[model samples]
Target: MNGSIKWINGSATLSPIKFIAKIDNRLYDLNHFDRDDFNEEVLELDNLELALNLSVSLYTPISFLELSNIAKIVDDNNLDYKKVDIFALRDIRTDKNFNTILNINNFPESIRKYLTLKTLPLKSIELITTFSKSLQDFLNGFFISNISISYQKAKIFIDNIAIQKEALEGVKYIDGFEFADRKTSTHIEIDNALIAINSKIFPMSISTDDNFESGKLKISFYVDKVNSYDKFIDILNSNDKDIRTLIEFLKGHDLGL
Candidate 1:
């Protein structure tokens, strides 16, 4: 039998090619392939398409800057096509901000400048007390309104949180807060009152024990920052006596104190 042909539909025509080709002047049969042959080659392409669709569903659209980068890469590499379909090119551009985590150590200066100049809500606080004064200044320049202080280690975490609160005192620009405790064996109820009182000082949540074990407290606060669902900021700025009273009341009731 003749070799099997596969047709690829292009812009205005259908291009057909033999599924299998002869090599080294030897005749090769294409149609006699087994299931393993299809699995080794054809299945991978189908899986790749599935994966791409999944990614498209998971991430948002790309930024204009990223698109420019793609164009530059295409040109620099001397890609086969001079132009690509806008939608196809867009699909190739993964959203960089999607699930992005802006930590004290990893916050990008370019992003901060762009957001700050535009007065955008794309920036957040990464409250790390261990940073140098220069780094702290650099982060504070972003005009972020919310900060997340991670309480990872048992010993120094709370102390760091106190330091962050003191440092950010009367700083009106940053208004939101979040904290994480990585110690699983500890019960949140035991220290929930302390955390709630602290939360009053800044818009914050104490993610400890349960949250840490479930992996819900990811380092990525991008979504939290941009969405502005942080009521904790207001809570933090509230009167300390009022917050303490509320915590005491909650503790008396045996609720999430």
Candidate 2:
């Protein structure tokens, strides 16, 4: 009950455009939720359809300054409408094992009665309902007293090969032909540490936070279809890791790292 959830993936899609001003990254224990203090913004617009896919990895408690800085950065950016989709990978840590307790099976008596006429497996008994209502119900059922959101870090991958190629062509010093049909990758390093390892083969923008210094890691993939939570869960629950652990795990299995 007092450990991290490892990772949590979520997405929000809107028909009429909506804008976000702040994120409530607080963690609450059983029976205690700071709903009044939570700050979130949503607006109905007639311009565009927007969808946001997010994955978070936590390491430590996120401070108010950090969240404010993030909000400032977003507000300052001049974002325009385009048909591009963003795929991102994140690493997050929590102060407690909130996700483990977010299972319907934890309420076996209620679930059994809810599905008395059906013989579906426990794993298939998903509760994809309204976010607020579902969360409130879960908290009430589990007797959660308090929750605190810790450190959160994410890396976003933008798939814009056409735009990249076009930009490359405008560079007079560089020969566009050299990049023609050739896969390119960008590597990001900080203080001699490889933070992001990008590959044209997989074609994603990969990033991590300070937690990379530790052995814990997370990688994510993006799919085009809607309601891809199941796919994300499948991948998250399957074989995935940071570069170092991944190599070590593979090597231990008699496979080349």
Candidate 3:
């Protein structure tokens, strides 16, 4: 089908084109084009306020040649078309080559002057970092409600004796013990919990390396005395072997078990 743009409100459709000549203002939707139909002909929007209901896919096939020609048209006409909504471009995937085309094309001096463009479903993380550093700055300053923490995994050799001391001194109550810095695939375990506990009161006798290197980090926690630490270990052993799980498990056992 030939691409067409229209405005809709609730169940009503507004006039397809609305122009205010005095202010050089024109309003119309620009999202009716399919990828196969996107060409220089679409750039004829010189003196109009445009609204687009489409996603980002419309800009995928746009070539540099078309962009240059459009830029020239906007420059020669001295168009006063402000506020262009190209929100249709958001549907395009970030990994596609079209993204590079869009960024390079839209920044021409002439095209930028007459058009205030809005893109939909903004770019992804890697794309922002790769395409525009300014975008990264803007995103970093923007506040987000949810935050994710990626853990690093590494083979951590712990001096069981030292851990006992750190646990006894660094932590207030010692109901359970966990090693957050340890690797997941390693089959290491605290063979003697009671010996580790007794050694906590004495001087540091065990020597071991604490450095670990991996993409995931461990976060073991001590559970309450009422809860069985052995059972917690068993549960963790049965799962993905992440230290965070143990910490979370202990956190859930708040009854001082």
Best by TM-score: 3
User: lDDT: which candidate is best?
Assistant: 1
**Candidate 1 local accuracy as lDDT?**
0.35
Residue 62 Cα positional deviation in candidate 2, in Å, after optimal superposition: 40
Give the clashing residue pairs of candidate 1, or none. Answer: 145-175, 177-203, 177-204, 200-236, 202-236, 203-232, 203-233
> Higher TM-score: candidate 1 or 2?
1
True-vs-predicted CA distance for residue 79, candidate 3, Å: 8.8
| Clash count, one per candidate | 7, 26, 23
lDDT of 3 by residue, 1-257 (tens): 22223222112222233221212243232443222322322233434333231221233443333332333333344532122222123233222433342353344332222112212122321133252333322222221211121111100111322334334332322223344654332223321322343254222122222322222223344566765677556654544343344334334433121
TM-score of each: 0.18, 0.15, 0.20
Where's the lowest-lDDT run of ten residues in candidate 2? 149-158
Where model 2 places Cα greater than 4 Å from the true spot, the runs are: 1-207, 220-227, 236-257
The per-model lDDT (C-alpha) reads: 0.35, 0.28, 0.30
Q: Which order, best to worst by lDDT?
A: 1, 3, 2
Write the candidate numbers in order of decreasing TM-score. 3, 1, 2
